[model samples]
Target: MVDYSTQLIDGNGEFNVTGLDNFMKAVKLRELGLSYAVVAIMGPQSSGKSTLLNHLFHTRFREMDAFKGRSQTTKGIWIAKAVGVEPCTIVMDLEGTDGRERGEDDTTFEKQSALFALAVSDIVLINMWCHDIGREHAANKPLLKTVFQVLTLQVFVLTPLEHLEPVLREDIQKIWDTVSKPQAHKDTPLSEFFNARYNLYATIKQANWDASKVREKLRRDIEAHASSVRSAKLSEIVASFEKKLGQALAAPVESLLEASEKDTWSSIRRLLKRETDVGISEFSSALTGFELDQATFDKMVQNLRDYARSVVEKKCREEAGKVLIRMKDRFSTIFNHDTDSMPRVWTGAEDIRAITKDARSASLKLLSVMAATRLDEKPDKIENVLFSSLMDGTVALPSSQNRGIGDSADPLASSSWEEVPPENTLITPVQCKSLWRQFKAETEYTVTQAISAQEAHKRNNNWLPPPWAIMAMVVLGFNEFMLLLKNPLYLMALFVIYLLAKALWVQMDIAGEFHHGPLAGLLSLSSRFLPTVMNLLRKLAEEAQGNPAPEAPRPPQPLGSHNFKGQTQQPNTVSSSVPVSSVSSNISSTESGDEYSSPQLTHRRVSNVEQAESS
Candidate 1:
């Protein structure tokens, strides 16, 4: 009983999209979809077009009052739903044609409105005065010509028996023949172009007698229109649903595939099922008005499920194509970053062999996950086979190595896996073996580089000589040590020389410099040794001449606190007042030359000298 009415177009030829939308919603016209029918009325000014529609379709379109005299009434196209009609008819009342308000020069709105009515309406009622039926200048003639040119459908003339002459029908036929036709339908007859012609009064009496026949015709026409529209829209709707599902599901599936957790495939299956179900539900709701058969509905739903699986398969294939890059990335992530996700320094303490094993295992797990589609929720031996055959190198030995011992065939020699289907497999066993080989080949340089760095770190931190070398020095230099101990001034001079040598060593970072190789270290030392020694001598001479000594250098900082470029801080110094006494005490207390001359012990000895000077 809802009365929904809206002006569809203004007099200025502008369409009222907002008003139309509101009217359509109010009338629930969209709910009908293609099942609805449209009926429109168009004729000359004051031809009672609106009055005829208001009576015929039970619409409340505004009609001009006879007492108010004839003029423009409906300014534009007005749309309203028919109160009671089969197949939900919508009616439009177009503005009157050839009005004095818009002079004869402007038949633009008339022609445009007529064309729109013919294009959209299933039934058009052209209301004209009975007196203007055979007149050459009848106002409805141009409207009929417009309809004939665009389309020729069934026509019903509503006139009295007196005006329904044979010549009147001849004039209508002449108008159709004279109207311009597309080349495709130029020679087509009017009867072939249109469905049927009926005199209104006679047909109404005939319809009253056999109403069921008339109803059947109307039903057939509605079904034909709805079927054509539904067929075209069905494909579009399914395609749109598929596009939406893919857009929503692709990224998350790719991410989960990359992660490859324990339940990754299960999680993906759940996700696909959830999304597909939602799509099917929404698609079903959208096609409810189409009244599709059960088989068609089930087929469409199955197609959606198939599309979802295809999307997963496509994503798996894409990830498989980039498996090598992902494997290398996984290796680098585990190898380069520590347990806390910090970059590894290869400080000689880390177990590179165990770390390489773990990293390869993780990469292998990624390969196993991507090697096949697991929608069946079944586990495979991809990981175990790959690890044992490729990583552990447990393949069959060559004939020479076998030496009459029986051995199993290589597991990775086959192009497929046991108990796995061809469609489900993305990467076969042989392909995985080849990929692992390439992965190891690509990552070998990183392992070698880590080993080199660890070796360098060990070399740079080794300042003291080996225990055997220390024992040799103690045995070979025992006589010299005794000679220096007998002469106190010789001992002091040796102590002073030792202090100078230690200072130069700290400043130059001799341990770090020698890490490259002994030859490189010696070459570097030879180049800079003399100039450095000359500079030290000049400074000592300056201090001896009573010039204030330079400030003492700060103690060496902890590892990672110092600059990485081998720049070392200068060593601590002893007070000049107790230099001889402190040197004698240090030499007496020292257990061995190697221990006493070490950088750590040197710092402690200087700290003791400073404390003694303070006390």
Candidate 2:
């Protein structure tokens, strides 16, 4: 067992982030005793998982911090105690995997995080990215597969409420006094628990299993315990208990613990199937209670109880949810926003905005306040707290009606922020598989270059010092530094030097020693013109980047190609309307043999996909 020392490094450290930030995080975790479980963020680079965690968990993990022209930013496991979280609830932000664009051969961190999560985590939350739910080879797939495989090794039978039945788990409490029937409801124990035990003993007997010495020693002890059994139910199980089946039955645990995950996946699948409708095999599994063995059934029943009771804190939530939501609604009403969905919560009343451009920031603020209030800790910075307030309903519209703002308007009146609904989180998915593929190709090229460099260097028996690269980097510094000196002010300094030379010539009685000579005048003229020329060149370059090499226009596509028009295609629909970005992209990119090239947007919005396929 790895000793519980407060020093295991997380992914942030893997990326070479150190110093005071690391020290403070370590200190906080150690003090709170919250560094036990590991929770990883799994997704492609720039997926906003880090941003979301940082925003939600109050972490300082930087999002997409790669310098211009750098490879992947996140390199390894970064551990930190989730801020505003309970003790022993550590969040291990893992380096996202399957960044095939980054490099293919090195998946050391991915493998490492999988093993770490399996070994240490009691609850490994696979954060369902609002996007990337169905894409094959999506960051979640490999990560989930690893989690599943390794989880096989560390199996313990746990019956959590969410495992057995989901419908019950989702039920809102009718009343507080009314018992939501204790969450762990495994009353009728599976008869198979006893039957399976009998079969195990029979298998052992058939194998001629024996620990003769242990049996002889325990004969009297067994008899004494057996006599104390009052009920026939447990007695039979106790008598038939054999040790070997523990290994066989461990993988599925309840088959019920999977109920939640499976159900969650299925729900996600259907939702994906409907929206982008990548139209994979329509074959889907239907849950049939009768097909499950009694042991499987009983375990399911038990798991739901545990999950609902503790993890979900179903009862306590019922009480808190009502009060908090009401306050949230008031804020929403004032802002003309929807109460149920804004983004997050605000710290106090003053941090709110009448109408703001920064929705993401607003949401973070809402979350900050809610989280802070929970722990009774003051929020650190109001800047991010703006975003958290989105969730708290403290964020709303400027008006009671659309296109309007001001007083007596519903705090959540106009409802600019569409609530996420009582279902899946809403986000814009950049289905840029093609873009990613292009990026992957570039990375692959770079990797090949790197490999060749390594081989050539090795063959030449050449050595490069760590500082040598630092020195080599100075070449870039030289180019940039030279460019800076070429600025007009520095050019003027050179002109001054020429004037000083002219003065010497005049003092020495040299011929034609004028300070205002044609040469000096021309130099001044060039200096004045150079800046404009440089500015023009920079602008041209920027515009070129902006318009990139006018993508080689392609032949028109067949009808259903994503190139076709969406709902707003009709001339009549153009009442000064813009095409819904998601639909427009789907229609637009379909024809381009290279489609997945969406600019990543981190802002959370009401997903039109869910609404589009609202079956």
lDDT of each: 0.75, 0.37
Expressed as tens digits, the lDDT of each residue in 226-268 for candidate 2 is 2343235333432232111222222322221222221322342
Cα lDDT tens digits for candidate 1, 198-273 = 4443223312244444445544655665566578799899889999899878998999988887788899999988
- What TM-score, to 2 decimals, does candidate 1 have? 0.59
Best by TM-score: 1
Candidate that would win on lDDT: 1
Any runs in candidate 2 off by more than 4 Å, and if so which? 1-38, 65-71, 100-102, 128-131, 152-615
Error of 2 at 245 (Å): 26
Off by over 4 Å in 1: 1-222, 395-408, 467-494, 506-521, 527-615
Show the lowest summed lDDT stretch of 10 residues, model 1.
Answer: 586-595
